[model samples]
Target: MLDSIKEVLITQEALQERVAELGKQISADYKGEEVVLVCVLKGAVMFFADLARSIEGDVTLDFISCSSYGNSTQSSGVVRIMKDLDKPVEGKHVIVVEDIVDTGNTLHYLLENLKSRNAKSVRLVALLNKPDRRTVEVHVDYQGFVVPDYFVVGYGLDYAEQYRNLPYIGILKEEVYQSK
Candidate 1:
């Protein structure tokens, strides 16, 4: 609900423009190769759908779900794969799509997992990055926004499994989480 938001951080228009730009950049970078997009669900679902359409080349979609936060605002520092990719990424150029990267633990765990499976190349494309909260180093090939460290929701991000359908990204009211 809009009542739960304190402010809109990124407008829907801005998100669309940026995602288009990212698509062009990716299409250029991987010109002749068939790119396998590994969607890190379920937060990245909305972004992944938009991003996939913007891409200009042959793109195949796959999904992998790794969770560090269950119902909490912060991660437990333990990355567990709730779901795994159905197909092999062996010798394929893989790009992991994520909605946000906060502490980098989940991304790191995912990167290692994909690498071990013999992906020809593994890169990251995150819609949002909270660099202030990062405890480990992460290399994001494409990033939409470097947001201030806040509990954000919308455009695929969520708070307690809610707010993912909001058209724009927004900061959740502090009291909402504090009360919990």
Candidate 2:
């Protein structure tokens, strides 16, 4: 799997440091209030776990799975919810944790859905943001990194369910996907 990587975009140490900083900021922002982290499943699992551990305040977790890309690198422009939150978000402080935000389609849909549920507040925390690829307008309250428009995989991000276990985020080789 390492052979398929073109370059490491973010090192494991960098990810850890940034996650810690984000956690501190989040903890401060909420000021000890309990917050529910709504993790976007599959891709965000690793980030969600680290962030949850790093946070200092009372934190609860929930998982929601949405699919915009199946086995392809490009977004299909349609978002589908594979799983919904186990509990209601009404009158609760909800923070949506996502691995990456690319085209913004999925997050936009999710934010609207969550807002309609009457949550006290709904905010987004994305590990990586690719504004160059965004087609819809979505606000990210907390962001870890701004990545270039490259096909990135690793650190809980994947290409066809592979490379998620890699410790760092890496740009996948063009041939790896082209040949598929």
Candidate 3:
């Protein structure tokens, strides 16, 4: 699988260090509140697990799978809830954990949906952010890194459902996408 990768974008050690720092900040900010982490699934599998462990206080965990990409690199500009949250978010200090923030459509849709559900407070915590590609205004409270626009894979991110198992984050070669 490594053969497919052209170069590593973010090393595993670098990601871990950043995650630890984010955990510290979150743990400090949410010192005396009921923290509930809603992890966006598939892509957030690795990020959610790592962030949850790094947090010092008690935090409730939940999962939701939403998608705007359908077998392509570009989003369809429409977000769909593939799997809704298992529990209601009313009166909870909800934090939406995401693997990457790209077009911002999914996060915007999610925030609106959560607000409609009457969550006490809602904020975003994304491990990676692609600022150049944002098509909509979205708020990201806790961000690990702001990256340039690139087709990145690994650390739960994927290309055609492959490369999620990679320990580090890497940018796919142009040929990989062009050939597809």
TM-scores vs. true structure, each candidate? 0.99, 0.98, 0.97
Give the per-residue lDDT digits (tens) of candidate 2, residues 1-180: 899999999999999999999999999999868899999989999899999999888899999999899999989989999999999989999999999999999999999999999999999999999999999999999999999999999989999999999999999999999998
RMSD of each: 0.6, 0.6, 0.8
Please give the CA lDDT of all the candidate structures. Answer: 0.95, 0.95, 0.92
Clashing pairs in 1: none
Score candidate 3 by lDDT.
Answer: 0.92
Give residue 109's error in model 1 in angstroms.
0.5
Order of quality (TM-score) = 1, 2, 3
Error of 3 at 87 (Å): 0.8
TM-score, predicted candidate 2 vs. hidden true structure: 0.98
